[model samples]
Target: MLDYDREAARYDATRGGDARAEAAAEAVEELLPRQARVVVDVACGTGIVTARLRRPGRRVAGIDRSAGMARMAAARLPGGVVCGDAAARLPLLDGSADAVTMIWLLHLLDQADSAAVLAQAARALRPGGRLLTTVDKNHAAYHTGGDVAALLGPVRDAHTPPQSDALDRVLGVGSGLGLTMSGRTTFAGLGQGRSPRSWREVIPKSPWGRRMDAATLAELGSRLGDLPDQDHPRPDPVYTLIALVKQD
Candidate 1:
């Protein structure tokens, strides 16, 4: 996981920025029930997308674990953001929120913590309300079917941990907690593609990459270096979102 406090300053620019935020918010809104008025965005880093989720007659607030990230969120939504750990508890009353969103949160946590966060989200949601979240976040980058994926797919999969936000895992967990899948959508991660050189730089710092042997890392770096258009980014990744509605 990243030191979100340190990354907060550059989070939006480095991420897909406004373009990506717009697409994500549009998709989320589509899945959200029109009657949903009280929405809570869990782990709503920087509130970039959270702010965009707002609409007339609807109230949206954000919750984040990092003070730095929450500060930025609070600026976008003054008096509407809280700094707290969603995996443990949400500050909202039980069955208080009409909707809860976890945009890019679960992939950062281990399975146990991810389950805890899902449970907490369920606790805060009203019956018939929905929980919207992204799934398979870390692996979305490879689904573009670019040369970078072809070269590193096998190795990457072998080194990667069990993803907490994988579609099946999420579905199963949500079902167990009385949150059944109600909708699904995808959005392009605009301007968030990686080049061969960029992959070489970031791979070594990734969670899976940290477990790779030095010689293997060096060889993978060499392979990435040999690819053409080292600085030209490949196709953008399309991220998946699923809406789970709480049963009465």
Candidate 2:
């Protein structure tokens, strides 16, 4: 595991303000009841999403394994933020949170650990409280074409992108731990559909999109240039926001 502590400062810069974070936040907000108050942002890197959750009367907390990440999150959030691992025991009490949000973090865990994390999230949520998570689409089996090797630079190892269905299955495992699916939202167009024109026109338009420097942006354009047109069917990275509610 990359110690996100050392990389916390630059992680958001590298990923840009991930759109998945916004989508996940929206999902959580919508799923939460009007009275729900306390919310936990799990695997909160640099507190970007946590900052967005700050509002009057709504208590927000952030938890992450990286001390650096927690520090960043705490600086942005007025609520309590703790440095802790998501896979193991969370530093919160059972049924302490009214809602939980996990963004762009599940796929990082292997199958077993992922389930453990989900279970722990469920444990922390009060009965009927919601849990929102964004999971990557199944790309390893569906992705074809595009200069993946060139874009990533130096293929270190053969890794499979977690299947969307596999993520659902993991959630199912957490069902035994008392979480039921309430709703879902999907956000697509991550790391795909970058044309030279769109890259130039769109990449600089948003904070998350603006992190790419001129060189990296040009390199991405060049590598993707050889591929079929953006219209071509490809494995688009989809972020699925699953809303799970704790069953009483």
Enumerate residue pairs that collide in model 1.
Answer: none
> Model 2 residue 15 lDDT?
56
Best by TM-score: 1
| Candidate 1 per-residue C-alpha lDDT over 1-248 given as tens digits, one digit per residue, 9 for 90 to 100 | 78999999999998999999999999999999999999999999999999998899999999999999999999999999999999988998999999999999999898999999999999999999999999999788877797988888888889987899999999999999999999999999999999999999999998778999999999999999999999999999999999999999
**TM-scores vs. true structure, each candidate:** 0.96, 0.71
What is the lDDT of every predicted structure here? 0.94, 0.68
Off by over 4 Å in 1: none
Candidate 2 per-residue lDDT over residues 1-248, each given as its tens digit: 67888898787756535664465466566656677788888988888877777667888888988898888888877558888888888877999998888877776777777887888888898988888887544332123334543343232112223442355575767678877788877665444433434433554453333555667656656655655554443444455667888899
Backbone N/Cα/C clashes per model: 0, 1
The local lDDT score (0 to 100) that residue 181 gets in candidate 1 is 96
* Model 1 residue 13 lDDT score: 98
